[model samples]
Target: MPTTVLVAGFRGSMGQKATAMIKRDPELELAAVYSPHLETTDPAAYDLPATTQVFNQLSAMDTPAQVWVDFSTPAGAFENAQFALEHGMTPIIGTSGLSDDQVAQLTKLAKEQHQAGLLVPNFGLSAVLLMQFAKQAAQYFPDAEIIEMHHADKKDSPSGTAVNTAKMIAAGRKQAPETVENPVETIPGARGANYEDVPIHAVRLPGYVAHEQVLFGGPGEALTIRQDSFDRESFMHGLNIAIKQVNRLKGFAVGLENVL
Candidate 1:
């Protein structure tokens, strides 16, 4: 039987793409779509069946689903996932901005319920590969900085991809990464945010989809790794993979790279 999937945040950029991708996949069923702002949008605007229900919350829906693929906002992501877990459904979360405490709580809930939950920071394959490559490169370079760029409308700074990359690099390195010393700070907050001693710079502007670069320096040599998402479709390939493999997981897994 095909996996029954409900998509939350169906009106957002990524949500719309995910809806279309799920419709095209024969192995998955588009069970329903949910968004708190559903009333403000037109149903005809979506490319779903005329019979499909678009509700504001999971509790209001009567349709049965085994998994909920949530690309909602940070505020809604946790609530949606928690509702799914409570209803005996697995949750696949793509929304960023969830705190570590929230993740820990979700992990504990998933473990208690014996449900496989997936919380992916970024779902683009090349992005995931970039992170893996950065981890491998960190051991050699040991000093790195990240610059992540996205469309101006992106809700979060330091894209989850950049934070995850920094963590991976920190894990792989032997010594602590270096920071600029005696830097003249004419303007505060110019150095960007630091994660595990690695600096991450966030850039938001128009005409860019999603892009990130990791630059490493050591002993007169430097290496750079970059990943770019030209369109939302770049993330679909990995999302499909997650949908197929999440059912087999014993507990919660973060990052699409874990399943890949």
Candidate 2:
């Protein structure tokens, strides 16, 4: 039997794409879809056969779904994940903007239940590789900064991927030397936000899909690693892999790198 999966936020862009991918794959089956805004007739009203049942509320769904995939808003994602975990269902979370405290709480819950939950801030393989490269270069430079660019409509600044990268780099280093002694500031907030002693600059523009650059400076040498996601398809491959592997994991796991 195919693995049964329930996708929340089924009407959104990424959610729809994931649904199509699941439908096309032979090893997965879409057991249900939950979206507050979408009704049961919405998909069929457009002359599309409903491959999965739609529910306005997650609690209303009675099907025994094995895996729950979240591609919804930050708050919605958390709520859906909590419900899934309480019900003994594995959750693959792709939502961004989750805070450190929230992540810790989820991790604790997963441990208590002995269930697995995955939180992936960025699903693009290039972004994962960028983080891996940054982690490797942290020891040599010890000083670094991040610049993240995303579409203007994005709700969160200092993308989660950038924050996670900074945390990873910080974890690998013993100490980060202060970059400036007497920092001069022409403006009040000219310098970007600092994550774990690393500076992070966020750029929100109309044209950018998602892009990030990690720069390392030490003595006379500098190194830079960059990644870009030009289209939504960049995330599908990683998301598919996470969905398949999350069931085998216990407790909370962050990043696609672990699964890879």
TM agreement with the true structure for every prediction: 0.95, 0.94
Separately for all candidates shown, the number of backbone clashes (residues 3 or more apart, or on different chains) is 0, 0
Model 2 lDDT per residue over 1-260, tens place: 88888888777778888888888888988887777776453556533346666678765777667889998898788888888899978888887888888889899999998999999989999999998888888877789999999988788888889999998889777666557878877996688998888989999999898999998988889899999999878899998898888877768999988788
Which residue pairs come into collision in candidate 1? none
lDDT digits (tens) for residues 84-178 of candidate 1: 88788889999988888899999999998888999998999999999999999998888999999999999798888898899899999988767
Candidate 2: the clashing residue pairs are none
Model 2 misplaced stretches (Cα beyond 4 Å): 39-43, 46-51
Give candidate 2's TM-score: 0.94
Give candidate 1's error at residue 48 in angstroms: 2.0
Q: Rate the local accuracy (lDDT) of all candidates.
A: 0.88, 0.85
In terms of lDDT, which candidate is strongest?
1
In model 1, which range of ten residues has the least summed lDDT? 38-47
